[model samples]
Target: MRKHTGKSVSRRLVLKAAAVGGTALAMPAIVSRSVLASSGEINIMMWSDYLPDPFRDAFTKKTGIKINFTGIGSNDDILNKMKATNGQGFDLISPTLNRSLLWEPLGLIQPFDMKKIPIDKVNPAMAKMGETVWNFGGKGVAWVPHIWGTEGVSWRTDKFKPAGEFPSYGDIWDDANAGKTMGRGHSVMLGAGLALERKGEMAPGSMWAAYQSPEKMTEVWSKLTEYCIGKKKNLKLLWNDADTQKNGLLNEGVIVAQTWDGPPIALKTAGEPVMYRAPVEGAMAWVDGLALPVGVKNVDQVYAFIEACYDAALAGEAIKTHGYNSPVTGADKFAGDVYAKNFADAYPGDALAKLNPWPPEAPWYAEKRTEFVNKFMSA
Candidate 1:
């Protein structure tokens, strides 16, 4: 059986590589924990293969705080699980930066206790992005930046050759690649759809408007739905999980697919002739981070888990095992020479400047996108 790794790439390097900067302030006070029974464990809801096993084991050994992981496949899955449990099942939740914003309005998450987190050790650029973007008008922080990466095309290097530079998201529509390509069945698909719109491959409009206005969302989804239906026959699969996508590429003869940067890197390291591309339109950039769910029972253990994530040694293992870059400063020192070189080559800093980061979308927008996706898949 083949092993499949999960999503995320480093946003810290991308921020530095792009030379972007902004100011941010730390959390003023730690939320007072209400008395509750000690569980001696920190429950984390995150994507599969996100936290390396070695790191989890080491964290437990070092701190005596057991890490209970509930692996999820997508951001929507995270939200669904949280809703099902009324945000009570987990202490720490990981969601993409944009999804984290939605949790605040839903009353599902609470602000981090800055005193417990090593805020000074986090990447300043990421801190700024979180404060300015995810923090709902500076009211309070509900999300803390952790790991990030780009969403782009991954192809079998042994099978397909780009004419020159890497192709655009429109490549998924190529007739010749029919029955050999796959697309993710999630809102990130909207990122690629919007990129196609930008390149004039689909109807033109403000992609952001789809997230803000019902009329505009209908307009965008109408175009997106039509475009997807046209190419549906070309797709070998519509994947909902990383392992399925990884196995499709490795053993099922899939030639190209939309993917997070991690899978291809893992495949390449394993000697598969695969490559992840930065499409001409732009890679869909994303940041997934830690958030405290409301009514968490083990508050101190939660802080221990957060600090363990930032431990340079553990951060290094995450990069080596998961193909993601840690947002914690100096974690790269532990990523080792070979993986570091591979990461530098795979995601050059200048190329990162071309990445289009995922922004917060309205709940209605997400609802409409899911509706269209279900329809497209069933069709």
Candidate 2:
């Protein structure tokens, strides 16, 4: 299994490793004696590079709260760790909206205490979306919107050319790109499955509805699995991490693959002829946010950390470093000209409006999705 801040591994392998307590799970870094002795330390489990170091330092300087960071490779890592500890290990976690649907119901995380943070500073639309997804069963607010991004197609313009306006998910099936394409081996597969259905290449099915009923799920996965089997020979890889996807495009000569917006933007910034496309079928937009785990020990520090994340300076720094959009309303004002311009260009006004957030899924959805992903991977 892959470590979040390190190498790449398949999602199926990682989940299995996590189940039996694999050593790949990141251990907490040693806290300085001064910070440990202080009453301001907050433990956080999140994607390794999601939060920039300068921002963490600035937050500590501003609030006197030290952040203990533990990075994980996938949402499954977050869920597995929380379950192993019975939600007692970390004070804060960053999970996507869909994964939180599973975590909240299991009592692994508690809802946000609105009064503790400056909720008004966040973008209203983004905040509302977070609330709808996190606040399950009217159980208090589960999380606050932090960073948002899209899952779409990233291709090497120097290697691949589309026959039409721009490439869509269908490019994965193009024979011209045989033995040079990749697909993510997780929930993003669900998004690509839906995209194929929308393009009329596959039979009609609701990717969203598959979450609610076993019958619908079986129907959807049957078509998706068959599609994968047909396309299997063309696929050179099935990636489970951003680094593998980026490296494949940059050095391994992969013509095209499903990817997050950040890597291609980074590659382009570094002079690679890579492009991230909001496909004609629509990009899958997602929000990852801060949430408290059950039995949290540092309430005051947790609130301080949450408040610090909303700071305009921190938000701007996040945008500059990771190519993610901040949910704070005015953070763009603090962003450097180049990054701001790049963000605007990547998500033009019309394109941004067309971005679709992943719909809420039932708890059973993740397990079923994983089962199909494992099947697709083995096929």
Candidate 3:
């Protein structure tokens, strides 16, 4: 057997290894952890608001494990940073529940020993991923839900009001909002597909079936991309992160957008006329959680961190900080009436059941989707 003499965990090398019979899975032995152990800090790549100073301080005070935190705005940021480093440096990542299954196959993440993490403390509804998508070959679960949220419509009530109880995703693409609307590129395409689905344009269940095969994915997404491109003239900006989403609505002359549940909700609480809700087409829901990276030096500290995150009180307190919901059971009780009211307002009626979950991505699906996303962005 020829040995991999180099120290780098670059994506090229890992994927190359995986192509030749899953040699990529043997990551624990390839990367040295002596360098990581000397630092003695748990390197975490997670959402910016997820690790507020108080949360970090409390966790550090309790476990004596300091966090070397790197904040990310999107899941793509998580993928990019990890790819740039070949999955090295960071001990933990928070891939979305739907995206978690792709990591182990790429040899980027290790699985969780379920017994070590407090999975039982998490809400059964949110924790189900640990038994399905996150589970790798029935051996170990790769990711666990920490915080969960939806992607839907947000609009400046004073600036614009569509004629509906719950505005449809179609409103964002309408000529009335042209040059005054915005959305994240690849994602809004998904929203547009849902809109098409509801309108009897795209086949029902086709969007979810995109994950089943390469042809199905391209067939579904290509139509969505075309529809989005036709409406491209209507967009004021394409936001990539939460800050950009808020800024576009508040300052960039954007009145309506398809957005994550967090930013617009926070703005509303702060007395902005902004409001976010489940669109008539349905909001896209997803879970973001901690996933261990391969070649972790501080495995014990990683497990400790996971255990601390399962604390319901702390998780609930984080709701106001990020404007997103917690997956920890009983978290809402600690979040107060305001959080309760906000959640109610966002999903008024059967919208919760109508949430279109982001399905797990197959590697080829990701590869081919990028081609369309780039085409739409440049178009």
Which has the greatest lDDT? 3
- Residue-level lDDT of model 3, residues 55-95, one tens digit each, is 77766655567899988988888888778878888888888
lDDT of 1 by residue, 1-379 (tens): 1111111244444755422310121111232232122236888888786876777766565556688898887888888888888888888888887665466578777777776677677777777666666576566777777786677878898898765466556666678888888878754357557668767776654565676788888887787788778778888877776787789899887888888888777777677898877776667777788888886988888877776676666666677777766777776776666566556555544556676666666677778778888888888
- What TM-score do all the candidates reach, one by one? 0.85, 0.82, 0.85
User: Model 3 segments beyond 4 Å from truth?
Assistant: 1-40
Candidate 1: stretches off by over 4 Å? 1-13, 16-39, 132-139, 187-195, 203-206, 348-350
Q: Which lDDT tens digits does candidate 2 get at residues 1-379?
A: 2121111112122222212210111111333333333456889998766766777766676557788999775788888898889998798999876565577668888887797678898866567655676787887888887876777777888888755444577677667788898877764466567668777766654666676687888888887877777777887877666677788897786898878777777677667798776666666777778888987998878876676677666676666666666777666665566565555445443454455667666677777877888887787
- TM-score of candidate 2 on Cα atoms, chains taken together: 0.82
Q: Highest TM-score among the candidates is held by which one?
A: 1
Cα lDDT of candidate 2 equals 0.68
| Clash numbers, per candidate | 2, 1, 1
Supply the TM-score for candidate 3. 0.85
Deviating ranges (above 4 Å) for candidate 2: 1-40, 130-132, 136-139, 203-205, 348-350
Q: How much is the lDDT of residue 304 in candidate 2?
A: 68
Clashing pairs in 1: 9-148, 9-149
